[model samples]
Target: MIREQATDKRTLKTIRYDADLIVVGGGLSGVCCAITAARAGTRVVLVQDRPVLGGNSSSEVRLWVLGATSHMGNNNRWAREGGVIDELLLENLYRNPEGNPLILDTILLEKVVMEANISLLLNTAVYEVEKSDEETISGIKAFCSQNSTLYDLVAPLFCDASGDGIVGFQAGAAFRMGAESREEFDEKFAPTAEYGELLGHSLYFYTKDTGRPVRFVPPAYALDDITKIPRYKRFNAQEYGCQLWWIEYGGRLDTVHDTEAIKWELWKVVYGVWNYIKNSGQFPEAETMTLEWVGQIPGKRESRRFEGDYILKQQDVVEQRTHPDAIAFGGWSIDLHPADGIFSEKPGCNQWHSKGIYQIPYRCLYSRNVTNLFLAGRIISASHVAFGSSRVMGTGAHVAQAVGMAAALSARHHLLPRDLTEPARMQTLQQELLKTGQHIPGITLHDDQDIAQTAQLSASSEFILTELPPDGPLLPLTFSAAQMLPLPAGPIPQLTAFVTADRDTTLTVELRKSSKPFNHTPDVTLETKTLSIHKGKQEVDLTFDSHIDEPQYVFITFLKNEHIQLQYSQLRVTGILSVFNKINPAVSNYGKQEPTEDIGVDTFEFWCPERRPAGQNMALRIATGIQLFSPANSLNGIQRPTNQPNAWVSERNDPNPALTLTWPTKQRISRVELSFDSDFDHPLESVIMIHPETVSPFCVDEFVLCNDRQERIFHKTDNHQSRSTIRFAQPVETSSLTIHLKTNHEKAPAALMEVRCYSVS
Candidate 1:
């Protein structure tokens, strides 16, 4: 191995040392790579140039991390890696309660800090690379901003996760940029053969709410003469924000050659466009929003792709290809931005393959010329057409994870990554991935003696209810306020449930409170249950109850005998009645009063059908409170106006309580609703206590509300809800909150049916 001698004049002093792998970039791919390698027992040194991580999908770019998961509708085979990615989703769900940037940054930072085997270096840039001849990378020269000193990181393997493929390019690895002619990859979307123009870059920006209005002002380079460009005609407020406009490209020559100039021109273009919109009086509300963020560096979408053992082609993507050595999967459509300095409004600007899911082979992830260097993320070896489909940051994250895992395995086995391409070794890697919750298509592992004994269930079922498992560590029992009914003398429970629609549905098991008056003592008790279901099949219903309203909220509680942590693989709820009560009460009566004394408690409850697929288990808990009303006094009570429900609420001194239930798998809930007693009055304000498992520490699914009139209203959480309310949104019904416990922990209260005064008539 070749080593670089530290020179006295280098101005860079070594601050930290010793890591099994040193990932050079702190972007999404680099973060994923570091975390994965660390989780697999490798000490990782993660160096990031920016103060924050997440790169493009960060607060700086304001871009969402789209994936081929159910949430984004791609549902590819490799959508099963749920370790750090899952944690990120949950963090985003909690922090980004409003889906904002600061929350996203917090989530990424949390992941980096929480990992035990990873050392994060922020505000550090890798300016030079240390290599062993032309084949192996030995270490990287990193600069720390605090001391203005340099540090050397030595690792067996290095990943060039930088979108620009800087490490590989500097190491003399073979790489290509732009597009080869259609004749090269036989791609339909390529511009006429040969190396052609590449996609331009953009400087993204954010908008903030300034109480005062501000006018838009054009930048120095704003091209006011859009008369020659027809694409400008299609531009609208919906597409153009103060920050995100591809207004200027090719004005200062090649984007790749003169990126700094391109970035400068793009900024001017953005401000100039905003000026045009303001000066032209195109939008009256334009003055209300101020520029929240302007890009410091242009987010480049296309760049050099390092050549590897296998160059993934468009045909492989079109064929729904699967490979024995497949390490990762990508499912975004072939999205090709214009390279000719002219925007295309054609429908085919982004191309799509007939098959959505595509496999990325392991051979394409490593350098073909460099013996030891590996590449992941957007810099992987692929033809231009194939890169277009796999360049998304989320997909790149998955690739980085797979590549990291492969690298770790190679180091442990004393073998190169190329050796793992053999079928048997690939199978071993696949098995290791599955063990860590990474999803591989057409792969399954057996932990038991009988394969035919797996439980089967339906995805369209209205509800699943069952008694807590009597024994076994796989499913623990919890006894709480709700009662548990034993399973009937049948293969499955004898619960009767049906659905009117035949679409896919989800079944959720929860511990809920029965509708009743709240008292000081605990009056409800429940037992936890363990049900079993097959991986993908939804079970048929034993029967149906027509008397039950559509979109109803179902609640059932699982009792925890001990503090046992549970995780669910999947959950779904369907055919449950979703009720929204708009109760407008006269808060003027309580205006001048010092606020009523602690009122009596209220209760709501739902049943857990005693029968469910065997081996299927769930978790349950409770939260309670009531929305108090006071009109003029924002100091004493949480209040909303009579006309608008979306305004803010004030919490005087009292806060509510919350309870969380964690399950065994990532599942979808079928039905959810709130409950209220007859003593409750209208102009109902605030959801006091909600007990959906979705609000717990694990799950992060989005919730929507539809009233009896089929009208939908989106819910936003306020300060009161953040500190006092149990769950942000009511699931589907009002009757399930009464059966759970009402703890006086200053945060728990009885559940409320609705806060608004208007009915859905």
Candidate 2:
């Protein structure tokens, strides 16, 4: 009877889902769009074709999650995708330093399930669209292969986050594919003639070392001649994960329509490469190695780019144009790969670095022909040349975040997706994004509803915290690269860095500054110091007298010495960004190389020696030992933590520390939000990192809130969350309020993220 019941339930059944917004696709962009909308009080139904959520970055494809940082590439100094993407990257860095894809899959799923407003349907692929008119998309029909069920999902607005823009294609939206001519968009790097040829698909494999020796034999289908491929020399049995991103195929055909064919071709290449590594007899190290895993699905690079009110062009990216309606920013270079992919005689790809980070306008996120359709991810409005840069997962995530915010606002206003064209509505969307810690270049947060800005901040005591754990492991400071440090506004006598040198050698250090706070390159040398350094475990100090009136980026160059290594930290804080410069043999920036112009630094293709995980900062500290961490920092409108490590920390053994907010006149407050420092190193993202599983002892355990004469007590049993919102049953009218807090686990020096007061009626 039970088996019969199960079998009957598995039979095909028709179901209907009505939501405010329908997100098609479960990639990073789709997940971000759905989560952001759900958080903003919109009913969202997230439809994913695959069982996992990360798309290419999942266990199936195993591609590294990359963004505007471009693997810390050149000209992308201090650039990171904000909003939901930041949380995901931070969580990944904290939990999976090894970059395990299976762990990441759980994180993405947990993020979706945690949201109350999101209804997720996995293993469901949408195959049909219901159009109300030529411009409107009324609904969609999806089939679930696992359950044998049909779903009719209806929504007022729709987001085409599917990498191939499947929904838009079915709705008859205008789109472009492949490459365009240089004359069409006036892009210098574009093809002389137009063609619909795209970048290809890639398959990756992982290998593991068995305790004992292992043997492998090649199958008949394996490539006998490995010499035919140019990259065969670099292949080793131990090379695994995304290192094989270059093992690409199927660029000569449609990347979306001909996906299965491309995937099979990639499979043959993977087997061929593995056979060469194991049977070529050239690598003795492979005797104990075995193929652990190989990706079945190929990670597709380029596909359909839908048409919107605005099409991002190559000139817009190369010139670094700022849009008036800019909602997100991207700093990756204009990277264009040949249509021939691996078979091409040319280098794998060509990249043209931009002057600086460029803005992505709001108009590019929604369809112009399909009225109710919004586009996210690689499907957004862009010329083929521009898509080359925006197609990156990180940049695409930002695009999705913007679309999600817009969808929420549109649903609330009962308007079409295009209704966001009005300045008032767009400002509301941008402000909401900023409240959630998303940074938009050229935009400042000035929301009047936030009570933190109105209060004068004071603390019980200010003390220097020198006992912080290293952000992560320290990396060697090579001779070719120089680190850029961000300094807060204050006077300093000296700076200190943890270092080690193989032999006694003098280290030259120079402090340079940039005119724009948003830029990464330093222009003027404020001072220079040379220190006689020791061989090992040395704390080097460079003494200087300087005062910065405002927050500034100071570039410190440690001239390369083979034996010398400077220490670094993975801990990230706001207003502080750490970047490095490397020795380049061929370089010309802004027309000249000698006495090089700092502006040209933006054009130099920069590459990080290792993966510079998002939200990392240098380990350099202030030698003066004066406490710089202030409670006032919590209200400075800077939510992102950079290397400087923002947040207020109480002094050791301090008694009765409290943060008080006062208003001259009585203000009605209905809610209070508290942000805690649950190990700033552990960043929150779409996926959670598993390491550092314990909660930070520095979190406040108990607190009493006094709103003038009325007092309320709240107790925190656990201190695991980074953010907490407390809503009073009734509005409290008060001229002043104070939060008296006690540290958890008897840990002294309590830390707090931010205190946000709101009156939501």
Candidate 3:
């Protein structure tokens, strides 16, 4: 049974409505438009037919948010032009530790709900546009699924971020569908002739690994031959969970008319594919690896585009044309899939491009025949060939930002989008966008020499270290007292740190290790501490000479709190020696230590390397001491004396604690050395030291070493370890370093012997 929300039809007709701008669609572009407008002080109403936002990227489609360029390519120029998008990226780095769908949904909800100027209505579909004549859209009628009622929303400005350009179409705006002949725009990628078909859609799914025995079962209708599409064969079913298996064509046989059948076929194909994988037993652990989710909606890649005042053509993309009123940018190549149908011709049968992104004029975002309506997202006016490149969600987001800003400016100045296209008005809009962190050509002007000098100086400077408080109330910590380096003419220069800890505790911090200057203090800390390190002379050595009646664990930590503005480059550490009270005569009278409990060797540590330029690589080495034993026999070593009733078994017999390490292997660095203490098994000691090998000194921006994963970014001296060091390849220009430590654990007390930053030459 489909259990939906109970609807009350009569009560919805009388509800009061309010909004200066009504954005119809809750996809990426629509959400960005609504958020941008709302942030600009305009009342915004964002409507979506589905219960969730992020049309293609939501749990519905399960499509990952792919930016213009990424680690995989140089096309991520769009991401560099940050705004609300940049804010979203930073938010995700913290909130979505695992970068999963549930976390992404939380981010979307928070972004929408936290904005006071925006009101979101989910499960509401826009059915009609109430317009004044053929040129002006006055209001819109929305069908609310939750209440089964109809509501009319009146707004001064309407943005059709709907990928289908629904509002523009209903309001009598001129629109185009399918492809244009090659001669129309002189686009090399255009079809030889015009056509009325569109790109297909896709359905996605998510999976996970259980690391256990499993089995697979094929679907009844699964075809062994066609199921193995060569295009998707490289993906390993055992590793990746989400698969784009349900790709199908639409729009040609009546998009609206064939949606139901298309949806059903997509589902059947998806299930069949999964069944084939399971039944084939190509993966023995297939049964243990469960399917976490399946997309609820098909992700539409193409739809009708509303014709705007200025139609963006393939010429604009290939020539890299700059528009006087350019509002957005496109980088993806002019890739056009077959319009006839999926598999009609091999995928990407008709595709061509200019090899780079180009300027897209602002005129292409608003309807040429309509005054009050603006269109963004996939439905922007562009030839089929050009639309192929500009249709990505990231670019759509940029377009939405432009449209939303234009609408806000129009409503505020009592002007239409057409008026804002004037040179002066357009320049004004461009300035606003640049200030808000949106990317615009001819906007980012800086001195190249200064940037280069800063990079050079930063690379040559010695590391600075600072220690933060580890107990009671947590406070903001600062690493460097100097202001943020100016944007250099060349690539962005970075600051790096090597962190180490002596004990374990939770610490909260931010992800961006380097930060810009601030007036007051920012709440977000950039990094956190996790795990521990202990090595020979090059790692860590703590020797405690004091004798005590009861055995105690030692600890050390590094933290990054709100006051610190920094970036992280690398982290390295070595576990060399661990001391316990097992060999002490007095402690031996008590029962053996429990296997789960720390055997007076509860210390944690790690190293933070300096950040370098984008292209430069740094070499680092990490080694550790080992003590191994069988798990079963290890429990036998837990011995108790006659008078000791509270004694527990020892874990020493079960071999040493397990350790797993990971670091960047691409960089080049000198060798790392680690040594262990011979008297670690004795008790009632003062401190032990883990030291590093002597090498030529270098400079670093910051250093943080901590035991706790949460406390890594923030450093406190109260939990200092007996041994730690900040090594650099060359002397740097920075002054002091800030360190954070965790003091939450009662069993382990962290100790710091010394904090130093030295010059190599």
Candidate 4:
């Protein structure tokens, strides 16, 4: 084949695309936004500057995705961010439990490519913005270096999720780059100039043992002195990736314009750190290790935050504010870092957590100045203090999922983003999000069209939590431990646990509850009982004269005692966990949390559960049962455990557990949605961490959907998702529907969180 040569001043291949909505950036937030919108039937064009879909979470960056759950360092229980992000995380856990970033890259790419309504452009950076008016972005111009082509993408609406706010910047969207003063929002925790104005960019590296001695050489640009880093002495050959999250820089510089310079500095530091490890003789383990990978780009923590109708401030997070137009939620702690980064003498970060998850209003999602533009990811209209909390990838992705649904609604009604903030429209938006398994605090599903809402529901069996049999291993009380129990609104029951004491040690047990019912912080102590224990194993009576006003989780705490060992049970329930008061340096939780100063942060003891294959329930029994699981709970709208166990759990011995929904007349249903217990409390970090299992033990792995005639409608197996939407080929008319469910693992009892039916999907 012969090709003709172009004349002087020849143009590159230019292409134009049109879509109903255009999303800039292909990070978790943007990718989730595009996927959600596409699922809602909105034509979408996803433009990403990088080659892969996930931004900081990509193989290139190697940062784990975390949000509420806070690495299980906080009190939020069953609080994992859901929807497309949950599906992706679960899939990653199934396919790559080892957390190879490359496998995650493929998962992200596959998700985007599978959507028929999405058009993705990789390695393409937007350079120009075209506006239909002063406030509306009509189109954008981008160039793909790998393809040597230019693209013009136009859409009715635009979403700026490009971590750096590039599109919003070019479109004249109002934004703030630095932290607001303490006086501005009465944010006592706001950083002073001495600390830092903006959070910095972080770099990470991985090391591998080569089985034999390996040699390493530093590049010319490598950092010659690792001592320049104040925390350099803390490094170890065993730790890598996020464990070294403090290797940050560039908060003092222009995070956007000087990104290249910042990257270079990070590269120098990473290489130098590796060089010191290889040749410094401090780490003999490094003799058989080599630098496997180093992040080419830094994971950004802060940038230009675009302004919306409402700027989420510190009070909104601290108070757990309820918004009238609530559409999303966040539970990550307000974490801020010093601008000096790794070189600073101060600690790496300052984090403060809230009592519970807070609602994110729809008003904070769209730009006030840029009418047609929506702000997502970390760039949303959150003040510096609030951004410190809502900036995590899972939170941002969940928020952007709402943005996606909003875009789809806007397109369907031919309206703008602002119009969706109306009372009626906002309720509809919240309902839609809940239907998709999105956990919006204080909101429950209220779909008038869901026929199941009017049907008579019954279950084969309802679990009555009486005891956790002492059938597993015993764990040493190296840390203060607590058994989380869901109790009714009455007198607290007497408890008992099997414990072995090495000596005649005094054991302290405290009955406590959270200041708020939904919170698990155990801030309010009801009673304390000190018992004298002899050396041998014995059943200790933990009878404390305690009473509660409402149904809430009561923490039966056993103080740390090296002389005692507590019994663990193999039995696992949908919403029960045993937590330990210990330190997780990553989140800065050192059991008891207290601010260095009076920074309006609460001081409390952290009671977080350990990752599974470990965190088994304590062997305990209550003479009076906490009858929480009922058939009616399956229709209560709330899908996850909150102040109470809001699920219909069957008895462990029940051979066949099933739910039946009966209608007075034959009903034509197009779709049936089921929400199961997927252990929402577990933080499904997608990279750099190994997950214990692919599917949740509480998930219904096998289920049968049948019509009134007992005719099988759909039989599903190996179901691992939190939400399962079953759509019939055609409308199925039936007077009754029965769902036979089976648990994913024998350790967990069969549980159903919610069941909803719709005439129109």
Best model number under lDDT: 4
lDDT of 2 by residue, 1-761 (tens): 33453343454699999999999999999999999999999999999999999898788887776665554444445466666876676566556655678888988999999999999999999999999999899999999999999999999999999999989999999998878776777766664322226888888888888978888776776666777777678787656767666787777788888999888777777888888888788888888888898888899888899999999988777667878788887766666666666656555665556645788999999999999999999889998888878888888888899999899999998988778878888888778887775667767667788886787676776646443234455556663344454466876546677778888988888776654555554555677788888888777766767666676556655666777876766543323345555533212122212323322213332423222243235456665554556887667554544434456766666787677788877878888877665443222222212333334444565667777774664445444455567787888888777877776444336666578888645
Ten residues in a row with the worst lDDT in model 2? Answer: 586-595
Candidate 3, residues 1-761, lDDT tens digits: the string is 86768776535553446678999989878988888888788889898888888877676765555433311122111122245654554445434535466666677778988999988888988888887776888899988878877878888889998777778778988988777776776654555432345776766666676677555454554444544443444334653323342255563655544666666656666666666566555645576776666666778878788888888887786556778887766655455555444334344333233323467788998888898888888999888877877887767887788888888888788888889999989887876664444655434312221111121111111111111112122112232111111111222222222323333322332222111121001112333334233321122222222221222111111243333222221211111111111111111111121223321111111111111111111111112211111111111211111011111111222121121111222112121111111111111010011112111011111234322232332222321111233334533332222232222222112111112222322
Decide which is better by lDDT, 1 or 2.
2
lDDT of 3 at 399: 79
Worst ten in a row by lDDT for model 3? 678-687
Query: For model 3, what is the error of residue 55's alpha carbon versus the real structure, in angstroms, after optimal superposition?
Result: 0.9
Clash statistics: count for each candidate = 117, 15, 128, 1
Tell how far residue 263 is off in model 4, in angstroms: 0.7
Quantify all predictions' global Cα lDDT against the true fold.
0.49, 0.72, 0.49, 0.90
TM-score of each: 0.59, 0.81, 0.58, 0.97
Best-to-worst order by lDDT is 4, 2, 1, 3
Could you give me the TM-score of model 3 versus the true structure? 0.58
Error of 4 at 452 (Å): 1.2
- Candidate 2: where is the Cα deviation over 4 Å? 1-12, 73-78, 92-98, 191-196, 463-509, 523-551, 561-579, 582-602, 605-630, 641-658, 663-670, 674-753
> Order of candidates by TM-score, top first?
4, 2, 1, 3
Q: Can you write out model 4's per-residue Cα lDDT over 1-761, one digit (the tens) per residue?
A: 97988877878899999999999999999999999999999999999999898998999888899988899988778878888888898888879988899999999999999999999999999999999989889999999999999999998899999999999999999999988989988899888875677878888999999999999989999999898998899888988997788888987888888888888998999899999899999999889999888888899989899889999998898788788988878989999888988889888988888877888888888988888898889999998999999999999999999999999999999989999988888888889888888888888888888899899988888898889999989889999999999988888877789999889998999898999887888999999888999998999987877788888999999998999999999999987889999888778888778878978777887889998988999999888877999888889989999988899999998899999999999999999999888888889888778887888888889999999998999999888888899998999999999999976578788999999998843
Model 4 misplaced regions, further than 4 Å: 1-8
